[model samples]
Target: MNQLPTAPPVATAQVPPHLVDSTSRYVESGLRGAANTVRAYAGDWKRFNAWCTLNHLSALPASVEALAGFLTELADAGKKVATIQRHAAAITKAHELAGHDSPTADKKIKVLLKGIAREKKTRIKQAAAFTLATFKRTIQSMDVTTPTGLRNRALLLLGFTGAFRRSELEALNLEDLAFDEEGLIISLGKSKTNQLGQAEEKAIFYSPDSAVCPIRSLQAWLRVLGRTEGPIFVSLRKNQQLTARRMTTKYINLITQQYLGSGYTAHSLRASFVTVSKLNGADDSKVMNQTKHKTSAMIRRYTRLDNVRQHNSAKELGL
Candidate 1:
C-alpha cells in the first residue's frame, strides 16, 4: 500500500523514523477519537497490559489464545458484557497503534464474545423518567432564593429542556449562551456524536409559569453569577460562594439524585426529555433535532416509556 506522509509506512515493511514521528503526533492529538474515548481506552489498555504481564504474555502483538483467555477470565469474574467489549476494543486499538494485526479479528474471538453475551444477558437498566407533574413539583420544592438553589434549578431545568448529557452540561459556559426576544439559544461546541466539530444549536422557549421556565431560571442564575463569560455552572465553596472550577459529571449525578431522589441519574434529564416529548406527540424527526441523535434507533433507546397507559397504541385501537 502506498503510504501518505501522515500515515505509517507500508511498502518499505519498516517505517522510517521521520514518518513514525509525524504519525505519533496525530495519534496523541485526538485525531483517532474523542478525549473521553481515548482516556477510557487508555485505562482499559492499562489493565490488559497488567494482566498480560502477570501471565507473561506480550500485550502488543498478543496471541489470539492469550487475548481470548484474558477476556474469558474477565467474564468469569463478573465483568459486564459491555465492559468486556470495551476491553476488546481497547486491545484492538492498541494493536492498530503498534502496527500489528489485532487478535480480536479472529472469528473464534467473535464467537466467544457472542457465547458469553448469550450466557450472560445484555439487558441494561435505564434511568427512570420523571413526569411533568413530578418535574414541576420538584422544581417548585427548590428554594431558588439562595444562590445554590438558583444554580441547581437552572442546571436541572436547562439540562432537561436541552436534553443535555451531564458531560455536555458540565462543559457549558456563559459565552455559549445567546439570549433574545424569543427565548434562549445554546451554541453547543461539541457533543459525543458531533466529534468533527460542526456548528450545533439547541433552542428553548419561555414557559407560562416563570418558576419552571428554563430561560428565566438560567437568567436568574446568571444574575447571581455576575459575569457574562466563564463557566456557567460552577462549583460552590463552603459558604456558597461560586468557584471558577467547572462541575464534574459525578457531582451532576449526585445533584440529580439529591433532587429527584433515588432511581435517577443525571441521564434521567435527557431520558425524560425523550420520554415526555415523545408521549406529547413529538415525532422522531423533531425529537432527533433537539436530541442531536443521528438515528431514530438511538432515540428509541433513550425513551423510557415504562407506563402501561402512556403512549399505548392498544388503547387507541378503539376496541
Candidate 2:
C-alpha cells in the first residue's frame, strides 16, 4: 500500500516574557480605535519614546517635567497646538496601557498646553466645500473614457453623495455595494464612529441626468474593473493598469486636490455634502442623517456659513 509522505512540523519562535506582555497590552489598546487612529497613536508614541531616549529620560513612567519639556520642544520646532495636544494624549494612553499614571494629567502639563495655545495665533484650516455648481464642473471635467478617469469619476461621485470619510471610502469593498432600482446602497462594515464593527448602510439615489448620476458613474467603473470581488477603488500603475490593492487614504486627498486644487482634502466631499444640503434648505437633523454626525454641534459647524447668511438678523432689519 502506498502512503503520502508526512510534512515536517513547523517550529514556532518563543517571544520573551516582557515582550509578550507589552505586545498584548499594545494590541488591546489599539483595538479600541480605528486602524488609522491606532497608526497615528503608534507614531506619536514612537516619537515620544525617541525623544525620551535621546534626552536620557524615562518614557514608560514619564515625569510631568519631561512631558512638558517634550511639548516645549515640539512648540519650538513649530508644531501646532493641536499636534502637541494629540501627542500628549498618545503619551497618556501609552503610559496607562503600561499600568502607570499619565504625566499629561498633571496640572503643570495642562497649564503648559494652555500657555502654548495662548502663545500661538495660528488658525485651523478647513477644507473648502464643493457647491452644486463646482461639483458639476468637477464631475464634467473628468474624462471617463479611460480606466483611471472612470475610476476617479465614480470615486468622486460616491464620496460626495455618500458623505463618507476618507478611511470609509478606502475601506469599501466590492461586496459592500448593492444596486437596485432606487439606486446604490453601500454597506460599511466599520467606521470611525462604529468601531464595534457594526454594519451601516448609506444610500445614493439615481439622478435624472446620466452624466451627473453617481449610480451611472459607479456602473461604468465596475464595467471597466470586471471583477465581482475585492476593493472598489484600487491603485493604478503609471501605465494605468489597475492593481489588486486598495487605495490609500492619502490618495483620496490627492484625488480631491487634483480636481479642486490645493487646500481641498478628502473631507471636502463630506463637508460639501453637509454644506450643499443645508444651502438647499435641508435642516440640521436631515443633514445629520446623511452625514452620520454624532452631534448637532458638528453639523452646525459644517453649515455655519450658510446659517450666518440665511438667518442673519440684518436681513430682517430694514437696511
Candidate 3:
C-alpha cells in the first residue's frame, strides 16, 4: 500500500489576491495615519510568517497554539509587551481578512498580554515648573563678544520668544519667515505647540514685536549674519563665515546642555512661553493658535494657575 504524502509548506505570497488588494487600498488612503499604520502591520505580518516557517508550524489562520509559540519566542527575544501586542493585532487583522476566523483572536491574545506586563519605573518630571527666576541673569552672563556667542544669544532669544522645538528651529528656512511692519512672522512647520496628538497641521506663528525686546536682538543677528535667504539658522565657522548648511537638533541639545545644564531642555522655553502667556491672561484660543494646538488639553498642562492664583489672592488680602 502506498503511504499518503505530507502537504507542502504554504507560501506567504500565496495569500488570497483580494486580501492583498484590500491591504493596498488601505495603505494609499492619503491620511497621515494610513501610511505608518499599514506599513507597520504589513511588516509585522511578514515577520510572523517567517517565524512560522522556521518553526515548521503550519502557518494556518487563527491557530492559537502557533500564536502562543510565537509570543513565547518574542518573550525569549526580550521583546516588550507593547511590541508583541502590536504584532498580534496585525496577525489577527490579516487572518480575519483571509476569511479565517482567528483561533487566537480573543482568548489567546488575552493570555499572551497577561504575560507581557508594563515596565514599572519612575516617570521623569517635566522641566517646565522649575522656572529659575535667574534665567534672564544667566543669559546676561553669556558672552556676546564673539560671532558664536552672538549666534548663541540669538538662538536663546528665538527659543524663548518663539517657544520652538529644536527640530522646528533647525528646520527653519529663510523663506518661511517674514519681517513685516508689526513684527516677525515665523512660519514654524512644526513646534512644541503641536504636541504629540494634534490633528491639524497649521504652522506656529511667532512675532518679535511683543513686549519682549529681545526679538530685536534676533533681528540684529539676522542682519549682521548677512543671511537674506536659505536656512535662517546657519552653522558658522571660526572665521565667522556662514556655512551653507543649517543647525541641527543635536547642536540645539548641546547649547542647552552647555548653557542651562541638566534640568533645562529645548522644551523648557515652550513650557515657559505657555506659563507666561497664561499668567498674562492670554485667552486659550489665542494661545491655541500661537501653539497650533488642535485642542486645549495640552495647553492646560503648562498653565498650572489654580494654586498660584490662590496664593497671590491670599497675599493681596493679607490672609
The best candidate by lDDT is 1
Q: How do the residues 1-319 of candidate 2 rate in per-residue lDDT, one tens digit apiece?
A: 0111112222224656557666664556453467777677778888888898899998878999899899999999999888888899888767655556889989999899988988997656567786789889889878887899999999999999999999999989999988888888888887888877766789899999888999999999999899999999999998989899899999988998998888688998999898788778788877777788789899978763644564456876986
lDDT of 1 by residue, 153-202 (tens): 99999999999988899889989998999998899877788887799999
Quote the positional error of residue 166 for candidate 2 in Å: 0.5
Give me the overall lDDT of model 2. Answer: 0.82
- lDDT for every model? 0.86, 0.82, 0.63
Cα lDDT for residue 252, candidate 3 = 80
Off by over 4 Å in 1: 1-31
Higher-scoring candidate on lDDT, 2 or 3:
2
TM-score preference between candidates 2 and 3, better one? 2
Question: Candidate 2: minimum summed lDDT over ten consecutive residues — where?
Answer: 1-10
Which one is best on TM-score?
1
Model 3 agreement with the true structure over 154-201: per-residue lDDT tens digits = 787677656666777787777776665556777555344343333432
Better of 1 and 2 by TM-score: 1
lDDT of 2 at 297: 90
